[model samples]
Target chain A: MREVILNSYREAIRDRVLLVVLAFGVAMIFSSLIIGPLTLGEEIRLAKDIGLGSILFFGLLIILFIGNRVLYRELNEKTCYLILTRPITRFQFIAGKAIGLFLTILVTSLILGIIFISYISLLTGSLQITAFLAVIGVIFQLTMLVGIVILAATFLNPFLGSLFTIFVYIFGQMIPRAILLAKFYKHLAIARILSIFHYIFPDLTYLDFRELLIYNNPIPLERILFGFSYAICYSLVMVLVAGLIFERKDL
Target chain B: MLATFLFQRSIPPIYHHSEPLAFLPSGPMVEVTTAPLGPISPEIIWLAAIQYYGEEKISGGKFEFLTQVFDVLTRIDPLFDHAYQFGSIVIADEGRSPEQAIRILKRGLVKNPSSWIPPFYIGFVFYIHLRDFAKAGKYFELATRRSGAPEYVYRLAAFAYKKVRLRKGSILIWSKIYQNTDNQTLKEAALRNIRCLILEEYLEYLNKGLQRFEREKGRKPEHISELIPEYIDSIPTEPFGGAFKYDSSRDSFISTTYLQIEKIIAYLNNKLHVFKQKFGYYPERLDELVAKGVIDFIPPHPLGRIYNYRFGRVIR
Candidate 1:
């Protein structure tokens, strides 16, 4: 499992795709320093905004496109056949892949984060913890998203898997609001259906800490713990489901 | 985020959306603009707004896009207290959007209940620009109740009431400013406004009575007392513990202090006549008159005691 994790992480990093994403993220973050001064009195706020926004956006892009392909590459390259022949169970394989994906997103977000934080620290003359907190939330959110993608990949092709995963992530965040909106439009039937969907969906909004960071609102420890716990539990369940499905599949 | 941009609610093209925030920017414009970047959206928009404001003067003294600019900014970061306050000031003073400024500040007050400056600026918008004294007083009073409100806010509240002739309200505010302020200049100014308000109230009272007396008796009344139990119930007492005097020649009410000045002038005139009779040519100065023994002494004027006296003409 450790070798699987390291090889997968190294393989993903060696690709040109991640490099371009990192370059874009870096360029965007630095561009904010120039864009921020054009803004009137809120230069710092704008700069911080650009740094966090670019990191969140590009990091998520990596998860959506590159992240969905993690297990697919193993299956497509026919490496799963050799791995399955070994003593390792299907659960261990999926778990290793999940960890590898986690490592990949961690490295991606960290590079982008370092570049962003360095630029911002130079601007403010001090390190801002808000961006770090927001990045932490983004990392957890992407991890959970990757877990959902892995579960989808077990049942569908990589393209359909990624598409469905994006839908699930976005719609999950909107489920609670959709229920409220259904009620507001006075459709009791739709509202009830949406409430059912709300209970089943993994709310991505739970991990959205950008507003809290930008506004400098108090972030209680319990809230962070709850969000992190939610991501862990949800992703763990996805990995278990994916392992169950992959176990039944004929290589 | 891209999805938010694709199907983003478009701002209604119409300038008038006279609903809840009808005068406010359309909901579509605000939501779409601020939805992308989280809280940073407001900071960015606020900066953009500042640049927009600074780029050009309000053409023809009419500002446009004011509501959209601030609405988007505040909607992006509702806790941006300075943006709302500063936006309102800009809209009112520079943008010539007094109505929009009032609207924005009121919204700011709702979001930031603890902020005193919003209501203070709101009061000024109504008081200084709109000329809606009643609304001005209401907002000023609200401002004064909050923490960190300035000493002059209370004065403004009272002054607003004073303008619509709410004597009790004016007096209350004036008395508050007079007693509350430690600054001598501010206290003196407040006292002056109060005294002038009081004098105005007195003059108004006498004018009404005089008009009524003239209508009834078919002539201007010789004394304000003539109106007692007829046109007026009773005479009004001077606020300074002095009396009001009726100037028959001018057909106006004057302060009784003028009477003392008049008496001194009369005495001086008699001495000048005596001096002119004794001397073939009139003395150019009062001290010269004294030196020539025209009179025993120069009678001091009541208002300007021992003041300079010079004649442009020789008294025949």
Candidate 2:
């Protein structure tokens, strides 16, 4: 298990994809300072908006692109055979890789988060503490998405897994609003189905901090804790189910 | 996950029916036809009235219906920010009910404690339309204390307080802004406007004294200083580093000494007109006109307060 963890960490650190995503995220944050003035009364608002948006978007891109490529690259290069010959279990290997990539995302997210917050403070003469809490919330959301991608990859090729994960990410963000819309249609059957989707899907909207940042509203601590718990529980379930599926597969 | 899969499969496949009900006569039939067939559940009707109230084509009875609908919408979703904004603007600006707008905005604030937009609009309505500057200043102050209130709002509140004669309050607020702001143009503008306001108040007192003198005497006063015993506490000094002068010849007042040149020209023209009106020819000398009683007292030129007993004639 220790060897698997160390190897996964090294693989992610050596990966050039992480570097590209980090550069893009940083460049976008700096660009916000230039774009912010054009928005009239919302200068600092636009800065925080573009900065936070870039972090989430570039983080997701890195996760999907690198995460999908990791396992497939190992499989295509026949490195999985060498790893399997060792005493390490498949579950340990997958868990270590997921954790390693999660750490990479956490490091990158924090770097961008600090820079964005500093920029906002310099522009507005006040720091937004809520923005930090919001970044953590978004990280949890992405973690759940990473789990879903790993689970999908266990049962399908990397390409299909990445596509399915992206679809889930998009749908997950819309699930809450979708459920509300379904209720308005007066179709009990449709509402019931939507409710089921709501419960099963990891709601990314819970992590959204754009409104709070733009409007300077304080975030509720209870909601943040609840959302964190939801993400953790959902990701654990996906990973465990993926383990069960992988254990039964011939590969 | 299994529960969700089972629920999806449990509903009857009505969507797959060959003959769909197209022409539903009654509401119940429409409901039945539109009901979700498979595992999909029907959408819930959450505050349907809100949608109807937002329609722009509503008029007369429809407008009244919309108000009721909005009330229902607010009751259902008290934290709906957009509803409060639209409803408050409609009631205050269009309906001309500042009281109703205030009540609605207060209710919205209670539900959404973090919102600043409602408080900003509340101040705006009171300041601009109702002209209740005191209430407007209070609301604007509250908005500034909030997290998202813009910087310009603070300046506006200071101006409003000044309009309502809250001089100390206005000066205090503006002083704080002047200290914090780095924009030279904005700072200078604020300082200049405040000075002008202070000067205007003193000017008002002088004009009121002049008016009281005229009311008592039944004609315009000969000089502003003559009202000192009756209407004024003491004669006010000129504000812009100039002294007041009284002209006995033209029975007029002037502020600065340099205005005497224009005053002499005006006095000469007036005496010429009087001479022509009385004797049908221009007066040969200023004293000749005074001797003839064509002018009991030669009024001073309107510009200069110093008497200028000069003679002149009109060319044509």
TM-score of each: 0.61, 0.52
Candidate 1 residue spans exceeding 4 A from truth: A172-194, B1-25, B28-64, B90-97, B112-121, B133-316
lDDT of each: 0.70, 0.62
Task: Specify the highest-TM-score model's number.
Answer: 1
DockQ of each: 0.13, 0.03
Q: What is the Cα-based lDDT of residue A202 in candidate 1?
A: 81
Residue-level lDDT of model 2, residues B112-206, one tens digit each, is 66667677667766765577888888888888888767787787678777774555444544454456444343354345435534444555666
What would you estimate as the lDDT of candidate 2? 0.62
